[model samples]
Target: MATFTEHYDLIKPGTDDYYDVADFNENMDAIDTQLYQAEQDMAGVSEKIGNPGDEGEDTLFGLLNPGNQPEEKADFYRYSKTEIKKQIQNWKPNLSGSTTFYGKITTFRAEKNGTVYVKWTSSDTANGEFYIYHKAPLSILEAPDQSELGSSIPKGLQQEDFCYYHINYVYSSNKGKPTTFEWVFPVIAGIDYTFMWYASSASSLYLNEFSLGYTDTKEA
Candidate 1:
């Protein structure tokens, strides 16, 4: 059968042409050779540390190591600044349909459709429930065009080229009652989002930790 690459080829190769799609698994030795070559060709760097002699602290490179930072970044959301951290915390949003007396709300992310759904499981049904009102951007319906975007976009966020979203959340417990609360937020355009929730015992609800993320549709 013709392979996926063959189907995608702009100009079909003549039957005589040779093609190899080993998937890098047919020969373990060849795979090992490639790995060795990469290790040999990669670069090495030596840098200074913040507190060089003190074993208590970490080096600059150590801080920048893989998995150490967020995949989606913003000049406005840098962890290095107290103000930035505060801003991100402030921007945290929530979308759960329920609330709690402790003032914490659940969060849900539904990718395909504009509707957001949540599954709440709690032993306390009455006091454990919360109410949520969804708030989202207008374009959660607007498709962001990746083809027209410039290079200024971040790595993970480019997927949102066509996705948009809004946010809303609340958490007000019912006092000693435990129950699951599920709410669906109305959405149009899909988007990358950061959701935050706080416990709302009274009419005023405070913000707590947030969920930050991004999502995109398949390229056309």
Candidate 2:
């Protein structure tokens, strides 16, 4: 009795025999390696397309670290003007325009959307008033951006205006003890800001210890 052999097994040894399991496995591995390399290349292309221009460009996953893990930046930033010991007599004095910069606390930078915190100390005997004004660039103030129309700012502001009141605290409660007030101001990304403080009093309200804080969206 003769047994029947498979048709593929009839091929000569090492003569391009397609039935060789070793050759089949080698080819499969090569194909798999090519597929994997192609996938990697495609992924790199996608990333480049997502973030154009210079390297380390911005992307939808910008909030992630290098390890693909979510990262959170410290939201609180503080700047103190300890040398701001000037006394303001006018009610609407522009501190930013002053030569001393009101103790050099005139400029603050915001890289992303957040809120600004302002704090200062005022010394008044009684019936004195302290004021805080927020100032922006002249370009935005001259035209009054339409986006600022719905803002809570007073309607009395003119077109060529950069000063807007954040708040005013009359020195009636803690007269000689020196009153302190904290104000919160909303901010937008990529905008430079300066704050002006004014005090009105006959006895000369001493202003000092100017400090500013803000919520930041920058990376830690």
Candidate 3:
């Protein structure tokens, strides 16, 4: 008979280690049993340690600011329609898409800290949007009469000189009804800021409501 390899032996016609078919089948069965036991042990260990897949998911608070500070939440303060329209002489859409227009008007509110928000019930405004401008509180006080000129700048949240921001784009057709928008500008502590809004497009829109608020960052 031919001699087989020393390290591993398998049944072959001419090999010295030739074995019966029954014996080969028994060896395979034993190997399978051992493998199954090892798999179970590995699962038990994983269960004790807990799954390591979801390390950073499902969290409420996050470290957003520098020096490991937690992100802040905004505290909302509402404004009345009377107070918002006071800054604007005529709150109608100056730019008209068509000769005839329907829907309510657009209105907004400003905060001392330069935060502004606007709400509307429909998208009748030409572009279904508006512009926000800020003027220094002192400037608004001196030129109370200047409020008639819608182009005149209002108190800015960051810098001076006729700075303005835009919100909402003209939608080809109406999306959903009843929506509110918000914007934030860097503002000084004691210095008050005035916010103004004007129609971006000719579409007529109605101003439903608005608000101003502050945000506080906290550690969780």
Q: Highest lDDT among the candidates is held by which one?
A: 2
Q: Lowest summed lDDT over 10 consecutive residues: which window, candidate 2?
A: 144-153
Compose the digit string of candidate 2's lDDT tens values, residues 50-162.
64222233543432323333333213212222222222222322323222111112545555676665566665443433233345545433432112122123333333355
In model 2, how large is the Cα lDDT of residue 88? 28
What total of clashing residue pairs does each candidate reach?
43, 0, 19
- What's the residue-level lDDT of 218 in candidate 2? 34
Q: Please report the TM-score between candidate 3 and the true structure.
A: 0.36
After superposition on all CA atoms, how large is the RMSD of candidate 1?
22.3
Write model 1 residue lDDT over 1-220, tens digit each, in one string.
Answer: 3332332233333466565444324444555776787676553223344432333326654455333434443221332221111121221222244333322232233354433433333322131223332333333213231112121322233353332332232234443333333333443444333232223233222232222222221110
Error of 1 at 19 (Å): 95
Error of 1 at 60 (Å): 67
> CA lDDT of 164 in candidate 3?
52
Give Cα distance to truth, residue 209, candidate 2, Å: 2.0
Candidate 1, residue 92: Cα displacement in angstroms equals 18
Whole-model alpha-carbon lDDT for candidate 2: 0.43
